[model samples]
Structure formats: C-alpha cells, structure tokens
Target: MTLRRGACLLMGFALLGGCNLSLPLQGRAPQEVSHRTSSFEPLAEAPQSEILSNLIQRRSVIAEDSALGDVARVALSSGARPSEAKLRTAKLRAEAENKNWLPTIGPVVSLTSLGDVLASLVVDQVLFDHGRKKAEREFAWADVEVAAVTLSQDMNDRVFTALSLYVTALRGQEKAQVGDRAMRQMRAFNRIVAGRVTGGVSNLGDLRMVEDKTQSILSMRDTAKDEATAALAELEAMTGTRFDGQPVAALAGLHDDGGAPLEVLKADAEAKRSVAQATIQRASLLPGLNASGTVSNSGSSATLEASGETGIGLGTGGKLKAIEASKETARRQVAEAQEDAARKQSRLEQRIASQQRQQAEAQRLAQQGQETYRLFQAQFRAGQRSVLEVVNVYEQSVRRALEGVDAKYDVILAQLELARDMGLLADGDAI
Candidate 1:
C-alpha cells in the first residue's frame, strides 16, 4: 500500500511538471519611431516666407510626426493625457489577461461531517484546451498591434496636415506679394490717367475707369494680405510658434521614396487584424480539459481526489456561432482595407502626374506673360499702346510665375505624400 501511494505521488508530480505553460504578455513592447531632421538650408535670396517655414520645422516640437508619437507614448505611460491614459489602461489590461491562463495552486484545509480536519496542497491546471488560451493570447496581441499601427497612422496624418498648412501659408504670402505689385502698377496707372485728364487728352469717363481699377486692385491686395494672415495664424496654432511674414524659397529636391507598394502594405495591415480575431474564434470552438489533484491527510488516514472535467461542444453553428460570425466580420474588414488601399494608390499616382502637368502649364503661362509684356513694349515704342498695358502684362507674368512656384511645390507635396503612403516618411522629412 505504501509503494502504491508513492507511485501515485510520483505520477501526480510528473503530470504537474509536464503541463505546458504559456504567458502572453511577459515582455516590453516596441517603442515609437523617430523621424530624421529637416535638411532645408535658406539661400541669401530665399523668400522670407520660406525661411520662416524652415525655422518652424527646425524649432517646433510638433514638427516631426514621430516626435509627437513619442509624446503620446510618454503621456500614455504617465497617465497625464486623458486619451493616452485610456490607451495605457487598455495595454495593461491586455498584459494582465495572460495571467488567466496559468494554473491555479494553493493550500486547502477542510473539515468533514465526522469532525475530521484535513489539509491538502491543491493544484488545478488546464491540461488541454484546444489552443483556446493561445488563441486568446494571439487576439490580445492583435489588439496591441492595432493600437500601435493606429498611432503610427495618426502621426502620419498629422505630419501631412502640417506640411499642407505650411505650404499653403507660404503660398499665400507669395501671392499676397504679387497682389502688392499689382496694386503698385495700378497706382502708377492712376497717376498717368490723371495727368492725361488734366491735359484734356483723356475724358472723365476714362479717368473714372482707371480709378475704379486702382480701387479694385487695392481691395485685392487687402484680401491677399488677410489670407496670408489667416494662414500664418493657423500655422502658429499647429506648431505653437509665432510665424512672422518672412520670404521663403519654393519647395524643391524631394527625397527618394523607399517603401513597398500600396497593395502589399494594405494586405499586411489587414492580415494582422484578421489573424488575431480568427485565432480567438477558432480557439473558442475546441474542447477543453480541466484537471485538479488533491493529496489530503487527516490523523491516521490519507485521501487523494484526482479529477478532471472535459467539455466538448458544437462550435461553428452552436456553441461558438457568435465567434465565427465575428471572424467573418474581420475577414470582410480585411477585404475592405485592401480595396481602399488600392484606390489610394491609384489616386496618389494620378495626383503626382497631374502636378507635373500643372508645373509645365504654369511655365508656359509665365512665358506667354513675358511675351505679352514684350509685345506691349513694342506697341508702346510705336506710340500705339499705353504704359499701363505693358505694366498689366508684367503683372500677369509675375502672377504666372507665382503659380509656377506653387505648382512646383504641389509636385513636391505629391511626391512626399507618395512616400508617406509607402511608409517611407520615416527616412525623409515627414512633416
């Protein structure tokens, strides 16, 4: 009898030692990525607006999207920001969930109906559960992945927004300067028309027309100035810095786009989400085995209760139908993500091409404007055209030049966006 008891003890020990154990959330997660510094160098003849843009990018804390991602992580860890704190809590909850899969162990004391007291070392383990625990763990891991990628996407969006704002603001400043030049030309025309009226060479109606034109140009100048002001204010709010009106150079020399095609990226993103959910659903459909062992001693008697419960249930159509449905939903979402990614890739490429065409068109217009100014000059030398006509053509030329500048920037912006979509913003100037 003693040998039999010793054998039972040895078998229980072996079972306990042989059970497979898994912990899902035992290590630290990866941190946010950092962006490279800007490589903008202002030339002596650079526009003031462009120079301010460079300054803002170099000095502002919110300039780099990755830097903001880091701030978000730090805030989440510190529980300082409300949104970040919630993410932190969710991450902690995911890590804590892994603890549920571990075996339960403790000391037990029981009193029987016959007034006998017993003491035992108790252990309960899930010997086999059809990979339910693993599936759940993988699901939890998916949540972490979703959160991480969500943060990255958000930061990328922020970078694009900042870039758009800065470019628009700089463009507004340049266009406002063009308006100023138009106003000056109108002022000179007004003077010349006044002199002609005094000399009886021009009628009051013609003088009135020129004065009205001057007034319109002045209004346009004011409107342009207001637009520039508003754009600068928006940029200031975004970067938390003052943006004084300074000349800035046109955007040029974009970095190389180094990233996978949009199709691959989208598929990868969807897979991460779907696989986790599928794991959870599949795990829930399998049978589970729960086992427990107790070795109790009371006075001259020893008792052993070795028991287990195994459960098998219908899964896809019965016990786990809800889980299966959820898995299907995840699949659908992956399909949608793929479609959206393809659409985005096509649209971005078209925009890059369109911007190039616009740049070419603007150059042609600038040339046409110069030709018009030259023709007016020739007409003036023949005493057939007024100086105002030549000056108006010159204004148009400057306007086209401004448009060309903006068009070039648009091309650069499109390229940057293409890089962003390819996940290559990590290498170049992102914001």
Candidate 2:
C-alpha cells in the first residue's frame, strides 16, 4: 500500500515538474528544408539571394529527357546515395536534439548498508545548463546543412562524370571517322604509285612507301575505333544505358554569373558546426543545476543538485581562452574558403575562354592544311612534286584535323568540369 501511494505521488510530481520548467520541453518538429536554411541567421541570405534561383534556371543545360539527364537519373537512383543518407541521418539527429531540454525518466538501483536492494524511479530535468542544450541544437542544425552541401556535391560529380564519358566516346568516334577518310585517300595514292611502277615510271620503293603509309592510316583508324568501343563500354556499365548516337552540342555558357559555390556553403556550414561544438565543450567545463524527483517503495523525495568540477586550476583560464581562439579560427577558415572558391572560378572561366580560342585556331589550321594538300596533289599530277611530298602533305592535313577534334572535345570537357564545380550539373531538389 505504501509503495502504491509513493508511485502515485511520483506520477503527480512528474506532471507538475514538466509544467514548471522555463525552457521549452516540447520542442518544435522538423520543418521544411527552406525553413531550415532560413532559420540560421548567418547563412540565411545566401540561399535566398540568387544561387538557388540560378540552380533552377540551369536545369535547361541538361534537360530531364536528355541523354545526360538519363544517365544522371540512373546513377542517382542506383542505390541510396551516401551523402543523402547522411543528410537524412543529420535531420533525424537534429529532431532528437530538439527535445534535449526535456526531463528524463529512468530506473535507479542501489544496495543498502545491510546488503538490501533499493530501487526507485527517478525523473531528472536540467534546470540550468549554461545554454548547453541550445548550443547542441545549433550544432545539429549545422550538421544538417553540411550534409546538404555534401549531397549536392556528390550528385553534381556523378552527373559530370557520366556526361564527360559520353563526350569522350563521341570524340573517339569522330577522330576515327577522320582517320577512315585519310585511309581511303592514302589507298588511292598507293594505286597510282603501283601503276607508275608497273609502267617503269616509278621505282618499287615508291610503291612500297605508299603502301606502308596506307597501312599506317589504317592502324590509326583501328586504334581510334578501339578507344571509342572501350569508352562506350565503360559508360554503359556506369549508367546501365547503352548509347547508339551521342550528341555533340556545346555545353559552354551554362554557368550563371551569380551563385554561391558549393565549397563556400560547405565551409560556412562546417564553421558553424565547429563553433557550436566549442560552445558545447565550454559549457561542459562549468557547473550545471538539475532538478530531480525520486519515488521509492517506502516514500518519495525531491532534490536540486549542482554537478561539475569541484575546483578550477590555473590552466583553466588558458583552456577557456584557447576555446575562444578556436571559434575565431573557424570563422577565418570560412573566409579562406570563399577566397579559394573565387580564385578557382576565375581560373575555370579563363580556361574555358582560352580553349574556345584554341578550338577556333585549330579549325582554321585544319582547313588551311586541307587546301595545301589539294595544291600538293595538283603539283604531283603536273610532275612538279614527288609522290612522297604529296603523301607527307596529306598526312599533315590529317594530323591537323585530329588536333581540331581534340581541341573541340577538350573545350566541352573543361566546361563540364566548371559546371560540376558550380553545382549546376544537377537540380537542387534532385539532390
């Protein structure tokens, strides 16, 4: 009967205690992602300003129905993306931390001096924690933001890789086509040299040299075909979709001028996380007040307690100052990250511009070489140029054509890299 009365009394106190606390015991539930982004004052303006808008507008670069988009969809859906899973976990943890200020209930057991068992139900509520709970909540929120940035980076990387491989396969195919045309022209030259030798106008050595040159062109074409086949196989394995014909559309000019790059966002999130953690640690060094109610079989009791280190030594001040310094360090890291991102963006922009120029120059040179080869062919027929000189001019023209093909693909590859860095390869919602 006494134990039953004590249990009832404990239940009554638990309810009363829950009602008396100053802090919010029942915290708010998890909100939408936009709310999460806007709630943090430091990073609040960054997302809403223009980066997110630009991300939405950039979706046209890789439309949902395009081949690049198909590969992205397949790779993202292949399995649970690790960064996205981490983001989910961080949100769950934040949800759990939200209610950390609430009172806790647990069973407590002990032995009496006479070796008897003493058990009770204890309810513990932190009455004063020096803002430890608040700092912990902030830490959890920052973690979610960090995870969010990481997820975006991962998705962009995956899409960039898939798209770059597709471009590579196409590049190899185009080069092989150029090689095939060169081989056909070389075979024609070989036929002429053979007829000249049979008519006693050209020696056997000339015929052999033309035949060898024809063989070399065939080998180059075969090598290029082998490269295309390998790249296509790899792309198929990665995306689980085999491509029959890849598009050669330009991927440049897709990057917008305004946007916070992923690196800056990641750095800011991590800085907030670091500072919050340091606050939590500093709070741990100070005393905390807790209120508790206990109910035993015999009776019920209530107590208020202060828990922490009993003494502060000489080094304690230095430790506290060091923690403050660590916070400053975190802030400085964010600044450094912003600068680095700006430099890299500038460098990529410059590289893209330079490659575009190189592509144009290569195209011009290739055309000029073709015209030169035609004049050399005319001279050979007029007996002004040797068979070897005509053949050499043809090879030079083919070489220029191959260089032009490389420059074209190189520009596309660099553009894709820039897009990946800017987090423009995938949509924000998709991440």
Candidate 3:
C-alpha cells in the first residue's frame, strides 16, 4: 500500500477503536465485575466506620494527653511498616490493572519472506475475553483489600505492642512501689527485733528472721525496678519517644461493639481474590477475543483475533470444574474465619470479665487484710500477740495488696489483647 493510503487506513482504524478509549483510565474498576455481589455483604472495600468506630471513639477518649495515645501516635509516625509498603504496592498493581481494559500500544517486529525486518505499531483492545480482564481487575482490587487489612492488622498490632509495653512498665512501677512500702515495714520489724535481742527480750534468731524478710522485700523491689526500666527502654525504642510520666488511660469503653473483625475482612478479601483468580484460570483454559490495528512502514491492517491455551486435552474439563469448585471453597473459608473470630472474641470477653471479678475480690481481701494487720499490731502492742504474729499478718496484707495490683493490670492487658484482635487499637484511617 502507498504511504499516504496506509496513513489514512491507520487513522480510520484508530477512530473505530477510539470508541472504547476512555480517559482518566487509571484507578477505575470495571462496573460489572462478577466477584462484587450481595454474597459478600461486608465487602472488603466497604467503609471501616462500623468496624473501627468503637475503637476510634475509645481512642478519642483516651488517646489524648495519655501515654497510650502518645505511644500509638509515635509508633505510627516512626516509619512505614512492611504491611504499609505492601498496601502501596497492591494499590499500584490495582491501578495498573484498572487500565487493563484499555487498548495497549506497542511495537511489533517481524522478519519478512525477503529476510528483511518489518516494524509496526500495534494497538490491541479486548473485544471479548470471557470476562478475563474483568476478573483480573477484581483480583487486583481484592489484593488491595487484603493488603489494606494487613496494614490495619500491622498498625493495630504495633500500637498494641507499645501499649502493652507501657502497661508492663506501669505494672512494674506499681509492684516496685508496693515492694518499697513492704520493705519499709519489714525494716521497722527488723529494728524492733534488733532492739529486743540486744535487751535479751527476743532471741537473735528472731532478729535474723526479720532481717531475712527485709532482704526479700528489698530483692523484690530491685527486681521490679529492673523490670520497669527494661520495659520503659524497650517502649522508648519502639516508639522513638521518651516516656516520662504517661498515665495509663482507662480502657473501660474500648470493647468491640458489633462489626467485622480484621480477620474476617482479610478472609473476605482473600475469598474474593480467590474467586477472581479462579475465574481468570477458567478463562485461561478457554479462548479470548481481541481487536488489533497495526500501522507499518509498508502497510496497515486491522484484524480480530482469538487466543487461548496452545494445547487442549480432555483434562481441561476437569480443570475448569475444579476452578469452579474453588469459588465455593473460598466462600466457606470466609465463613470459617467469621466463626473463628466470634469464638476468639467471646473468649477474650470472658477473660476480661473474669479478671475484673478477680480484681474486685483481690481489693476486698486486701482491705480486709489491712484491717486484720491493724488489729494484730494492736494485739502486739498490748503484749497479747508476738512480734512474729504481727509480722506474718503484715506480710499477708502486703501479698493481698500485690495480688490486687496484678489483677488490675491483668484486666488491662486482657482488654488490650481483645482490642488488638478486633483491630481496634489503632484508628482505621491511621492505618
């Protein structure tokens, strides 16, 4: 063909194919993607308000002017997590895949019969692909959803870690305070025993026992101090912030209300992804139709093409059926994930309730022990009870007090655990 004739033919082909060419092509999903249906009620792409609102509200309450808030904000701002990077990558892939429906322009080089190279520019658009392109787009979007959930999971986990460390440090400090008070009381007992022994009113053995108790309390105080220092250092390292006197915020209203857990969302995303992949695999076993327009130095051509696997066998039918079955499997997996999350949340709630009860009981016993210790001290002063008996009562009171502290922190840790599992420790937008 003449150069001018080829140019006109190419222009005609271009105009014909331009009908499907849409601008602002990136980041647009195909409207009729199959995986997007009512079956997936809590769609992976759905707004996270329901899922994260309770936690977000809780954060609003406690995250300001609190240690937990500082730790979370600092940790989140420290750097991009691996999951965040993955989400970014998935977003890019989805954007690229969103434009998959658009025409592709590329150079084609071939050897002619005269042993000469021919160069042409080809523009190809999918006229029909058994919905393969749609499946691809769905897959890419699903991947993005999964990555988003992962990012949420990772961020929540990070915040949970920092908060847990803070809680640990707090627990250690409280224990150390308890130990210090106990040590002071024990030292007073030791002084009394020493004075009695020197006056021959008490034996040396009594003074030795009192000294041992004092040393034990001192050891406990030192251990607790060490723990607090270690936990504080680690928390500082993770959040890149120095934690001075951050108060522990009450986690009373941080429980999950009713929403999809991160695990369920991740499963839903994976299910849609699996179904989309199955569709693509099934399409691959079949054929795809494409329209192509080529402009070359020597000629111009327009053609419709159908392409598929280079080889086909009887097993192709079985493969296609297996691919179809995988869709059901993916759906079942999502249901399983939901069940698992429900069971886990129930267990965590039960644990929190149990810890709260234990804490209350411990505080009650601790108060009663304090009254008993006061009564014993009065008896000892009146010469009705021995120093040993008074000392034992004091020890019991201290033990009960320590138990109350432990139980209180246990509840906090359990609540934090529940929040982490629910993906509610960090705000969804923050993730």
Question: Which candidate leads in TM-score?
Answer: 3
lDDT of each: 0.56, 0.77, 0.77
Tens digits of per-residue lDDT for model 1 on 1-431?
54456347546644553566522244657745646422222222212322213222322222233433332223222322233334355456556655546656677788989898777766566666666666665555445434434433444445555555555666667766777877786777778778988998877877787776667666766765676678668756665655454433322433433333334443454555466666555555555566665555532222334332334534345636665566677667767766787788789779888888999999999889878888987997798997566656766676687788679768756765765464433322332
Where model 2 places Cα greater than 4 Å from the true spot, the runs are 1-60, 113-117, 309-311
TM-score of each: 0.68, 0.85, 0.87
The TM-score of candidate 1 is 0.68
Collision count for each candidate, in order: 9, 0, 0
lDDT by residue for model 3 (1-431), tens = 55676566555555554554444435766666554222112334323423223323323223545667777778777855887677678777877776676677889899999999999888777776678878897888788778777777777788888888888889889989999889878988988989999999999888887787778778878988898899999988776788874557448576445557789988988998999999999888888777787888877778988888544688998998999999999999999999999999899889989989999999999999999999999999999999988988888898899899889989988988888887777655444
lDDT of model number 1 = 0.56
Tell me how far the alpha carbon of residue 423 in candidate 1 is from the true structure, in angstroms, after superposition.
3.6
Of the two candidates 1 and 2, the one with more favorable lDDT, higher being better, is 2
Expressed as tens digits, the lDDT of each residue in 287-386 for candidate 2 is 8888787877657788989996544668878878998999999999999999999999899889989989999999999999999999998998898999
